[model samples]
Target: MRIFGKFLMGLMLVLAVACSRTPERGGYRPAPGPGANPQLGDSAPHSWDGRGPYGQQVHGIDVSRWQGDIDWDRVRGAGISFAFIKATEGADHYDPSFQRYWRETAAARIPRGAYHYFYFCRSGAEQAAWFIRQVPREIGSLPPVIDLEWTNSQTCPYRPPAQDIKRQASIFMDIVGRYYGQRPIIYTTVDFYRDNRLGDMQAEFWLRSVANHPSVPYPGQRWAFWQYTGTGIVPGIRGDTDLNAFAGTRADWVRWLQARLTR
Candidate 1:
């Protein structure tokens, strides 16, 4: 939610100077979505190397404004337990439909949460400020998440050095904490953790580990969610869509979800 360019120039300089000594805590790397793995094309069928046909438990999708013409009923029919919808973006950019869908899902009674794409180029406080403006004040929903990963898009291109990336993430998390009022989950990869020492943060992590089932690359560490694949097929959803299986069970889903009453 932090806007880019708001405080990036100053923070960029700070991260550049202080990144060599950050320590490694522990973490997870989510694999790919059920749709298109940036590494793989859209032609790849939605599937995973782990559990046969993925887990029969809680399932869901995280969509950006890009995925169009969605049939959410099919998604509901497919037994999706929850969905983390893309809401606010760095300081300025927001999906046009973020509010619309936020209300839509609220009406549909889908288990949902909002996410902010982290910008390593900015300070955490600024990013958090941007996110707070976007997210409505409400309670009992899924915890806010800080989506931190390597993204080289045009609007916010101009990558920082790798160590600086870690510093930026540290600041981003600090900022997100200020507003969200919870230690938000960090979504990132193994290499990012290793390179940036993200393990040091030890915040609740949503890992992208693309292997069979949920296995920790770094032993003796606990991870919150493991993203198994970008390609996934679920019953009721049209064609094949990307899917993610949580590390726990249906009961876990019920526990984590915001307590909302729906008829």
Candidate 2:
């Protein structure tokens, strides 16, 4: 009886130590360190390899009026680190929801920036001025983005020469960058980027490659952001919205923001 009692106490002690060392199911897990595997959570997740955008630590979204009535609080709470709201298109067309998104995102404490969609018919200078007039010079804003892409508008089918496109983009970036005190990011699709030889440009790139990794499509190109999907189902957004990932870890994201966010 004494030996049996002693054995029972030893068993209880071992079990207690094992239970304490083991993690509870659904309990807190430490955030991944730099170069560590990131936790993946996307509604329409891709079968991404270890090097894909899912591996990126910082994720964000770009929104236009099409997203409609966003719940900025939910978006911020959903682990979205930043946003780029469409402010202007061409020289005259302003996105109707730009102001609301800008205000709400600031209230939610999400780092926000504005983007101007380049209109083929409009001069770069004219479009840049329009964007400047529309987007406020707010402190702590992310650097402005110039969205460069080919549009299928019947009103503006003019595809300028590569040299001309480069020149116009340079003009827009120069003006917008000077105004914002940060170099503008150029957002472009694979075709548009190749056609315009945008790789030669002296600017950070936000490359779009939903089907494959940006490295696969944009070989040898160093990118700041990768637009990985256009049919993303984010919690705060209605319908499909574009999803993007920063090119570094959480710490790297903070450092980049410190260096590039508008003062």
Candidate 3:
């Protein structure tokens, strides 16, 4: 019995060593396991006013050609920690401002990412390929975002069935994920989320809620970013811009970025 107990202890030690040696990405630390959702504390008030309920939350903005030329230096100085610059749209319509925004934002020392506006009219593989071609693979950048939501444009108003939508989304994300070494984030609206049941997908979510908190629409789901308002007024930006909040504190945001780097 004593010999058997000693053998069990030795086996456990071997397993412990194996677990401790888990690989990391380029020596970066990994994220905490599930239930490690950002320490965002309690839910805050839901309002359409400019002021956010969470005090001193890490706020950022997403911009494209509509925002005209951006002074990224002034933006960074205004306390913006990050930005999601538009990269591509559909399979062929690359956002004209993508390259300039990407270059200027990085030069300003802002941790930025690129997002592709998905179109139902084009094949997922084609869209993914186009995005990959346009956005350069930069180290230490945020994971590429796949913005999937309904559009009212007359050009392509068709919404594919839920299954087809899911399949195409999966294809696009898989392609981008394999290329970037990190899972892509899905940005969707409330109606789209409900129609497609996107919460089941095994990827991070960037939900859009203009009035209510995300919890009202995306209950019991994990989200990394939230687009709380579309009429946000930022200093360097001329017109209204889409503003987003990282789901955690400043420390949590740093850890989240580190986790993506490790991924």
Per-residue lDDT of 76-190 in model 3, one digit per residue for the tens?
6555667998999999988889899988986776778999999999988999999999998876578899999999879998989999999998999999999988888999999
Which digits, one per residue and each the tens of the lDDT, describe model 1 over residues 76-119? 44445456778876767777767876776555445566788877
Residue runs of model 1 more than 4 Å from their true location after superposition: 1-53, 155-167, 214-220, 233-240, 258-263
Across residues 78-106, which tens digit of lDDT does each residue of candidate 2 receive?
Answer: 55778999999999999999999999987
- Model 2, residue 17: C-alpha shift (Å): 31
lDDT of each: 0.57, 0.79, 0.74
Please estimate how well model 2 matches the true structure, expressed as its whole-model Cα lDDT. Answer: 0.79
Q: Is candidate 1 or candidate 2 better by TM-score?
A: 2
- Candidate 1 has an lDDT of 0.57
Which window of ten consecutive residues has the lowest lDDT sum in model 2?
Answer: 21-30
Ranking by TM-score: 2, 3, 1
What's every prediction's RMSD, in angstroms?
Answer: 14.4, 13.8, 12.4
